[model samples]
Target: MPLSNNKSPAATDIYTISRLNREVRTVLEEVFPTVWVRGEISNLAKPASGHLYFSLKDSSAQVRCAMFKNRQSSLRFEPENGMQIVARANVGLYEGRGEYQLIIQSLEPAGAGALQLAFEALKQKLAAEGLFDEDHKKLFPLFPKNIGIITSATGAAVRDILSILKRRYPAANVIIYPTLVQGEGAGIEIANAIKRAERRKECDVFILARGGGSIEDLWAFNEEVVARTIFDITTPLVSGVGHEIDFTIADFVADQRAATPSAAAELISPDSAEVLIKLKHREEQLIRTQKQTLHNYQSRVELLSKRVPHPQQRLIELIQRTDEYSMRLKHQVEKQISNKKMAMTEIAGKINELNPAHKITQQIEKVNVLEIQFKKSITRSLEKAQDEVSSLSQLLNTVSPISTLERGYAIVTEPKTNKIVTNTKHLKSGDQLRIRLASSEIDSTVDSIHEK
Candidate 1:
């Protein structure tokens, strides 16, 4: 059945390598729009550009794959070599290499759901950073003035929150920052809403809430951005994302976590009826205290009235006492004047006795008599003294050393020491001696000394 090589050939289309690859890519993309492929990942390479290049393979075959940054950013868990994965991708050909490849639009871990894995991953991350720490959590406002709600405005969560708030505290004002609670990009929208509310500074507390839903529906609150935003804002936030059994990352990161949106409203809003009852009790206590205080004051007024005298009677008593005191004072004054007159006379007589003129006269007479007596006694004493002086002078001359000297008695003394030479034991040869005469002293040196 072999045909001859020389047979006339029919005209056919031809293509260059680039044109062939382009046509192949177009054909592959048109044939396989988007598909989910399951395989073990291998030779995974994540470049600085954030594009992931890898080979998805099974025991029998393999295929090349590339996930760009935009799609890879949405991946819940990191893709590693040998990790099983499911990739939603478009089949296409690389024009440069002319190789068939899968352009991944999304990726998920093979066994677990992507949203659940993402939630667990983010929870762990934020928990490790202490964002879910009790110390970082703020206390819910007891009586919030303005409550900011970051949730869908049209959802049942808002209606529940509003209804509970109205019933509990009509005074509280609600400001809604309408946000997406589910679906793509919902996390970013929720995070942005929190930031916007923060910048506006409208609420005393924030209730980031949503009604009960599946993990996918409530995934926005579990996002890292939303959790971090809730952590960063100054206002207290209450997270009420789902039913009692369900927990979101927002619940862990928020200031307070409520089981439901209605519960969150209850936590933030004060109970008006309970508050009124307390106020009423306080009012009763105040009234009772005031009445007791008024009674005490009235009792004191009555007691003071009994002790206080009538004005006219008090005035009459004062007037009568004044008259009696005036008469007694007048009588005392006259008696004092009479007594003073008598004392003045006595003092005058005593003063006259102490007068200087009378004293001077008596002193003059006494001085004249004493002068005469002194003169007579001085004359007698002078004569007696002269007589006694003559006798004493004769006696002195008899006992005086000068008299002894004049009588030829010689007195000797050591010249330098000026000591009398009473004992010859104290004198030594060659020592200078002084002979004391009546009129003069003679200096001499000792030639010999004899002890007697």
Candidate 2:
């Protein structure tokens, strides 16, 4: 707008809308430096230009406020009408319209309301399911191969984790899976990045991290998909979302929970030099125990040798016992032989006293008497034979012819030396002859007898 020069007999100076707006902006900036204003939000408009135009009022008065796209991206949660909030902003005039409003730089909850109730309800629901149970939590790997990070690539949380992991263990590897950590569809993106890392098997462990913000700002980690994905991950998870006081569903289901991005790095890997020293100490202990065992065995061997007797002494004792037994056995056998000899002598004397020779002599005398009786029988048989011979001779005489001559019958004889009157021839010769009657004998040599 053009300004009039001095002297009141003048025409009005015309100013363009842009010129007036610039002048008003200068005035408003000077009157109100950047400040914090508390009010209830209403008539909120979110247009395609990525800007939020809203009015903040109490019961009686209201003022317009604007949140540009660049500033809107910084808000962690959606803004709506009838929400009580405290806006930290600067008072300014719109260059196009010359209207004054607060250019909000930051925002926060003004009172405990719907948001606080929703927070408590979610916390209770997840807690009842044992999502926050320590027993179900996986212990972060002591030596992670590659730690995955799911956060904005340019965020300070990434730089913090990388710096800490490198300083503690220089050899540890890291992989970043970029994701939106807040706002619409951000929770899904954060969950998807975690699931993709698991599918790819790219990292041994994961760290979901972001710098501290309002509860609304950290709500992405509290979403259902992000929480379940952390619970379901095969890779061990480490959550370092927000500050120490901040808690989310991801923190409860994660394998390990760290209070900050730097703390998460520490949990993943510790100092290498300290681990080496502990191993060396264990090795020394084992060596000492083995040496003690060897010494004990050697002592036991020496003690056992002292308890055993020498072989020569054992043999000498056995020989003396054998000699004593041999002498006793020989004495017992000799005594038995002497007793047997005495018994045999007594038996021989008894046999001699019982002889039967007298009885045998008596039997021989009886046999001689029987022989005498037999001889008497033989003499009687001889007498009987003589009587038989005499009888036979008498019988022969009774039947003889000479018996007739004896009864007075005469007989003649002729002989030289006998005479008989039988033949006259013999008488002529005058031979000598003897004749006898029956009573007498006749003797004749040659005689002639005459025929009667």
Q: Estimate each model's TM-score.
A: 0.45, 0.43
Worst 10 residues of 1 by lDDT: 394-403
Clashing pairs in 1: none
Worst 10 residues of 2 by lDDT: 351-360
RMSD of each: 41.8, 63.6
Per-residue error at 432 for model 2, in Å? Answer: 99
lDDT of 2 by residue, 45-157 (tens): 98888888999999999999998888765565578899888787999998976688899987767742345446668778878988778887776666565678888899999
lDDT of each model, Cα atoms only?
A: 0.72, 0.66
Over 168-264, each residue of candidate 1 has an lDDT whose tens digit, in order, gives 7766678999988898999999999999999998888998889987666777777788888888999999988899978998899888889999999
